[model samples]
Every structure is written in C-alpha cells, then in structure tokens.
Target: MTTAARQPIVNDDMHDIITHVNEGHVPELLHCVKAYTPVQDATHVQMTAVYEDGMELEVTAPAGLSRHFVAYAVPGPAHEAIRGTVGEAMKKLGVKPDSRVAHWCLTENRALTAHFRRLTVNLGEDERADWRPGYACRFDVPGHEHGRPYTLRRVSGTTAEVDVYCHDNTLGSQWAEGLQPGETVTARGDYQEVTPDFSAGPALLLGDETALPTIAALLEGWADEHPVRVLLEVGDAADQRYLDDVHLPAGAHVSWLPRTGGSGTALREVLDALETPPAAVWGALEVSAAKALRKHLRTEYPDADVRVTGYWRVNEKN
Candidate 1:
C-alpha cells in the first residue's frame, strides 16, 4: 500500500493546541482495507500480491497464514470497507466469512397462497443454529449477483421457515419461486431487531404484510400485563388467515384494514380514533405511508418513541 505524506495546514498556535489534545487523547486510528465492488469481478486474482493502490490482508487458512491483496474501487475509510472485502475474499477461498455466513439446505417450499410462499430450510449445528426472533438472513442465490434479505418466520432446533411474498418475478423473486428441496443456498446476516421498548408502557404496532414476521417476533416477547394493539393493512381478507394460528398477547386487539386504493388512509383513520397515545409506536410499510405515520406520531405524540421504516418506495426501482 502506498500512502502519500502531506503536512498539516494548521499554523503554530493551532498545531500547539492539536499537539496538547493528542498528548492524552489520541484520535482512533483506522486500519486501511479494500473491497471489490459486487457484480463486477469476473476473474479471481491471486491472493499473494502487493498493489500500489490496494490493501494487504493477513489471512489464516488450514495450510498456513498468508498475505492477500484486494484492490479498492475508491479510497476512503478503512474500517467501513474492510469487512465487506474480507467477506468476499473468504467466499473466494471457500470459507465461511463469519458467524453470519451459514450453509442451509432447502427442506421445504410450498405455496401458502397465490401471493405468498412458505419455505423451510435445515440449518447447520454452528453459530447460525442459535437463531433468534427478529433476525433476518440474506440469500446469495445463483443468478442474483446482488443478494436479497428475508426475515425468518419460525425456527425450531435446526429448522427455520421463511415466508416470501412473490407478487413480482424479479431476480430475487424468481430464484425464490424455483427453489427446490435439497438445494443449498448461502445465508449471510446483519441481524436486526426493531421492536419497540415495552418498558416505556403499552405499545402499538402497525404495518403491512412485510411486517408480519417482525410483528410475530415481537409478540413472542409480549407480556400479558402490558396492553398491545396491532393495526395491519392487507391486500384482501385472505391474507389475514395466517394470524389465526399466531399467539397474541392477552388484551391485544388486532384490526385488519383492506387496501382499496390509497396507501395509508386506513392507518391515518386508525390513529385518529385512538383514545390515548401509546407508550411507543413501531411500524414498517410503504414509503409514503411510513413518512405520513412518522409525521403524525411526531405531531400528536411527541414524547412517545416512534419508529417507522419505509420497506418499499413508490414507483422506484430498487
């Protein structure tokens, strides 16, 4: 790696202050690293190398420890870039990058409805076996160069189930639709748990179909003493059947809204009818609806902890 040495532009007085600051408080040093951009590499480069404009990594393998160099497309922060580069390098070396990368065999794939499909996968007996609620995995499918993320709906021992919505046959959707039993897929994760803090008081959960898995996870940790309310919007009445087998909290009330045309009209109406502000509000929905919900929560219940994430953008191709 080649680093250009440049002198600081600070004058004597400023330099003196900076030196004093550094005497006892040194700024954290970032380790320089590099990662190849996804969907671009066609051929694998040799690991043993030295590049003028790249990062050199010390890799440990079964054979022995060796040095590998991966070039970066652009130069910037090292800490932010190293992990991804290391992950890709590990993949090339046919090794699991970390606990986040797991091998899963597809055990079952069945259509739940015309729009939804239920998939069950058998996991390995490693760190990935300790699956938790609210954790999602990203699938690196064969043809889909850029992976896709899916939330796990259920996990039992070495088995996990994922509910996939297949309304459109995009790259990710197409790969999911054709998945067969015994087929293997790489699952990587940056697990997220966005459930509201119930310790604040009673909670209100609101979202659409995409939020079902997350909502189910939140319900698993539900307490009977605290009141909980769920407001969900679905395409039709058929979509509500999945809730029949779910374990809801005691005193929990669920209201289902069927979308006629508008995005968040039902959610707005539901909020307007609330007798008291909830302790916290959590939701994931379409972009416009999520924005509207955030605005409403900020204006009406300013003191409440509100989280609204836009899962899909309107008329925007991801």
Candidate 2:
C-alpha cells in the first residue's frame, strides 16, 4: 500500500494566524483602542475600544444579542484622542464617520485595561458636593426603564444615596458600591417628573431606595407646606437607619418595610395596611415590584392617580 505523502504544515506566524484541524479555522490578530462615552445613569461610563483593520468583529446590534462592553469616560483631552484613534480604525474598516458603527459590540480591549484602572478616581477626604445629603443631581439615561430622571436629593447621609435590592443586579447597585462623592453621573434632563405640588392635595409617596432621593427632595421642597405620607421598602435594617436619620417634614408620615423575602412583598404588605385614600400616589422600585404595585393600586384604588416607575430590572445591566 502506498501511503499518501505528508503535506507540510503551513505556520502563518507572521500574520498571527493560529489554526487547529478540528476547528477548521485560524485566528487573526488585530489592533484595538480604548474609547469611552457618558451614557445617562451610568455611574462610570463603560470603557470599550476599536480593533485594527480587517479584524473580525462581533457586535450586538440594537435589538440584537446580549453582551457586555467595557465602557468608561475620560477627560476632554483623552476623549479627543480616543475618538481620533477609533476614527482611524473605522476608516480602515471602510465604515463611515457618521455611521452608528460605535454601537458595534466590541469587548473591552484587555490590552488597555491598565490605562482604565489608572484613570479611576478615589475621593478620599475632599467634600464631595455630589455625595452630600440634600444635594440635587440629575441623570439622562435613555432606554432606561425609568425613562426620566426624577429629582434626586441626598436624604440620610452626607453623600448622594440610592438603595438597590441585592437581587436586582442593575447598574445602580453596581455603581452604588463604588460611588465616590464628587464623581459626576449622567441623567436625562432637568425636567422634573414629580415635583411635589404642595397645593395639589395630601400626597402619598411610595418607593424603595431608588425612590428615596426623589422622596427626600419632595419632602425637603414641601416640608413647610405639604402634608405628605411616605412609604418605603429597604434591603435591611441598615437601610432603616438611613431613613430614620433624615429630617423629614413634620407633617410627613414615613413608614418602612424590609425587602428580603420577595421583590414587592414588603411594599404590598404596606399598601394593604393603608386605610386612608391618598390624593396622589407615586412610587419607584425594581421593575417587577413596581409593576406589581401599579397593578394592585389600579385594581384597588381606581381613582388614585398613581405613578409607578421600575427603577431598574433584575439581571439586566441597561
């Protein structure tokens, strides 16, 4: 039997191609650059970069696959540089300058990971105006479940505060842990969704940590004028202390419940306990809980003008 002559293996090292017989494909090397942009409600903008020319790219288009992109914001100077580099890379890929190609899904280029880490800020002692209680801040997070930035003012602590359920893994909780006092966060606009109209009537406000800031703001703005009833759900007893310490309007009746057993169980229990009809009702919480509360209120108190917001959704990052 004549054995077939063995074919020489072609190693494409110069082109950075690595191949495997079973895979039936070769990996190609490409160039990449780190770029960052500010998206509303994103504590720290995600950091992403562009790869070199002819580099195979996998992107999750709008209404497409789900994936994480590394994103972070930089100063004006660095932003300009990143934009230039990304432009050059896209030019090589034959993409138009104005194209929404930026939406193309690209992994956070690990090669520039060190640069991002170095850019992180640490607010050690300087008074962070943004973190102070009663300080107002706004964000513009589009496609965000909340859709709008309600007024937010710090309530319990000297820093800006937002409470999030451990189960609801959205950007708010992710950034809340790492948030520094002075760091800037983006919001949709200055438009106020529920500025307490003290003259409207007796008001009932309901929400969790996500709604706390707005609640605090409403209370502070209407303390001298409006009679408000506030109902809130918190993660645990620690959160209760935060609410207790805040100075609320004398007429404001505030109540709290722990959100542990289920998402909206605590809120539902509180709503069931209410005997008086509120002139207007407002609330914000995790999506499921908020939806549940909305449905219950609509069914039980049909006449009540209720505004319920899903501050964030579970498992969804944006």
Best candidate according to TM-score: 1
What would you estimate as the lDDT of candidate 1?
Answer: 0.65
**How well is each residue in 285-311 modelled by candidate 2, as lDDT tens digits?**
888887778778766776666667676
| Cα lDDT computed for each candidate against the true fold | 0.65, 0.45
Off-target runs (Cα >4 Å) in candidate 1 are 1-99, 315-318
Worst 10 residues of 2 by lDDT: 99-108
- lDDT, model 2: 0.45
Cα TM-score of candidate 2: 0.46
Q: How much is 49 displaced in model 2, in angstroms?
A: 43
Tell me the tens digit of each residue's lDDT in model 1 across 290-317: 8778778767887877777676666665
Quote the positional error of residue 170 for candidate 1 in Å: 3.1
Clash tally, candidates in order: 0, 19
RMSD of 1: 12.2
